[model samples]
Target: MATSPTTTGPRAPAGPGKDDRLTPRGKLALSLLCAAQFIIALDFSILNVALPVLGDDLHMRQADLQWAVTAFALPSGGFLLLFGRIADLFGRRRLFIAGLVLFTLASVLATAAWGLAPFLIARALQGLGAAAVVPTGMSLLTTTFPEGPQRNKALAVSGTILSLGYTVGMLLGGVMTDQLGWRSTMALLAAAGGIVAIAAPALLTDSRPTERPKLDIPGAVTVTGGLLCVIYALSTAADQGFGGLDVIATLVVGVLLLAAFVVVELRVAQPLVSLQMLRRPTVAFGNLGGLTTFSMMSSVIFLLTLYLQDVLGLSAFETSLVFAVQGAVLVGTGTAASRIVAALGARTTLVAGLTVQSVFTAALLFLSGDDDVWLAVTALALASVGHMSAVVSYGINATSGLPDNAQGLATGLVTSAQQLGITIGIPVLSAFAASRVGSLERAGEDARTALLGGTRTGVGVDAALVLVSVLLIGFGLRRADRR
Candidate 1:
């Protein structure tokens, strides 16, 4: 259980032979990490702008389109903890580089894909690569920067870049899909990945546990399979109705498997995630709070995109421009969030952000079919601010209390929770909307009328989720501060 020497504290002032003024090497490493984060974040939004184009070009059905998105999300969500533990046992640097390479290759394959199956397979590979990169990068940051101001600042910069990446991705995806084509967007991402891969080897120092533990195979299988099943079921429910037998069965099996995972972790010598860490008020509450906030945020974006295009009749380019407003606010707020957290404390800042977010979410429910565009945009922008602020605060707090060596697992768990929230949120909310729409249709409503009613119902459900998230965050803040 030996820790890296760097985790000890500030080292002696470097002499001429040892230069360390945020050495070129360190800067390069940070750059690679930031680029990796940007690419991963970009993947989340890039497809939004390209989906229509991809569908038209490939003759894809609606179900195929849904799979295109879910294919990436499910694997990324399912494999994070397993890969994070792998990174800890093997080498973070090695895994990070390998992930970069794999992602880049996947992007190339996707660019060349002429069929639905190939494209989806490529996306799944990209997801697997992302699973490796995120945890490894976080682990590297945690190991490189000792706990305190330096680590906090590093996390701040990383978080800001991550948010900015999402904004840039949406804008770029729109422009590229409109002008150059969807395939070109994949090529661009591949190029970015290549750049990261080239820089990673020189900048990242290989590190491994002095005494590595055995791989928790049973825990890994149970958790990964369980999460995959859950995500698959939820995604299925979105496409097929809530009463779909396959969806219900998959969800039931997933729950049971996850319960088995917990039991396995408790009895194993080296658990994939240490149950003891979850006992910590800061870690546990921060995760729950993050889960709630991300779930609402993810579902809101999904519903809003459909509403803007289908209900409001906005074009793709125009819709993307509107989405960019929220991205701008998110980046602006996220940059300053760390300083705000420092000044006000994590609990205060988180609570404030969550409360504001809830207010904005509720406000969206009042938007009528005839509402002004400015009003809708303003509400979305406010929600983005709150979402980004809370996310940054949670990221900082989640890693603060754990011992240095456990930071990778903590980061992975946090990321997994956020993904799980989104995975669960999209299907659940989509199902609510679809059911409501069905009821309205059964009442003899027209298709267009049903869609409008469904969109409103979806918005209402999202607002409710936001309110619940706010309450959970408030509870988490209180619990953490008391500890």
Candidate 2:
């Protein structure tokens, strides 16, 4: 177990009875942390709207376009544990600030990129920065706020910011890409990262590590390579088919490598992830639940964006607006979710949220080209509300049971699971959609008509995925209850 350095020289008299909210300094620090979080969240969804523009400008094929997204997702997904451990071992504030610098530099480079290779490299760099931000931000928040209501409130606010950033990113990316061009969006991201970098040193207090852990180099390499291989295998399967020898071999190797990583962690003196933490009911259930939900959510967003643009004849701006409605619902619900969690225990909230999301997603099956736009938007908003509620509840549960120093590692693990889910889910869903479309086309549908059918099939698959996610959550909750 590890502990953070407590504020040793604190002698300020108690302010009133109990309503001792954040001090002025504490409020500023929270603001800076939220800003960093917003940047990371915004980066995740911002590129979706810009992808087409970037593809056209850079003369990239669809396969290459996927790389632009994967380049960011894969590294960010895989390196979280490694970076989170670094934050805990060295210093949270140090790694946080360093990550900001690296992220900002990457954004600047990406903004200036003229070719696929440079842009992909820059995106990978940005992902590395994001890998640090998620865990470190949570660690800082947990340490800053005392336990009970105040900490819950802070967590709620952080969750809201995370959801809000995704919404704002879609709208902002659309506007930037339409007016200023795709490159300008990256430049704006750089500017935001720079601001965070400058504010970090001033607002964040340094805390020395309680226990310095040795770097698990072999574990890091094994896990990272395994994750990348798995993601690559799934991604390639979308285009090349799962029957390809390359896909099979890559997936096999990835699974073996990941198994090796687990074995290594169990034997290591200072493990990258503390396996003991996974034994906690709340931590384990929350992580698995979060992973399932996020996986379905990411695939839904990807498929829906495609459906909105290709089948519904929506411009990128219009598509972004549609997602914006969902985003707004996510923000509003996420901000209030902690109260809900307090009222209903985490297990109940998790189950309820997952159930609601499942229903909302299933409602999409009723949609068609002739359906009312407002009705579709309503369903999306409902789904968003349920989704954010689930996320915030799970997030609070995942971090609450852990010790302060372990917060980073726990957060990282949860985040890594979610990313891994997305990496695996996307290609599987895409392949299913392709298969459905092919079946329809073989039944005499025209090429254009078949493509439109494919979009609808993709949405259906997304709905099915959400249902499966519901089951996963329910199973995890049941397991927790039994324990």
Q: Per model, state how many residue pairs clash.
A: 0, 0
- In order, candidate lDDTs are 0.78, 0.76
Model 1 stretches astray by more than 4 angstroms: 1-28, 446-449
**lDDT digits (tens) for residues 351-469 of candidate 2:** 78877776777676665665346756887788777777777777777877566667678767766765566566667778877877788889998765666677667667667666676
Q: How well does candidate 2 score on lDDT at residue 426?
A: 69
In model 2, what is the error at residue 332, expressed in angstroms? Answer: 1.5
List CA RMSD, all candidates: 3.6, 3.0
* Winning model by TM-score: 1
Name the weakest run of 10 consecutive residues (lDDT summed) in model 2: 6-15
The TM-score values for the models, in the order shown, are: 0.92, 0.91
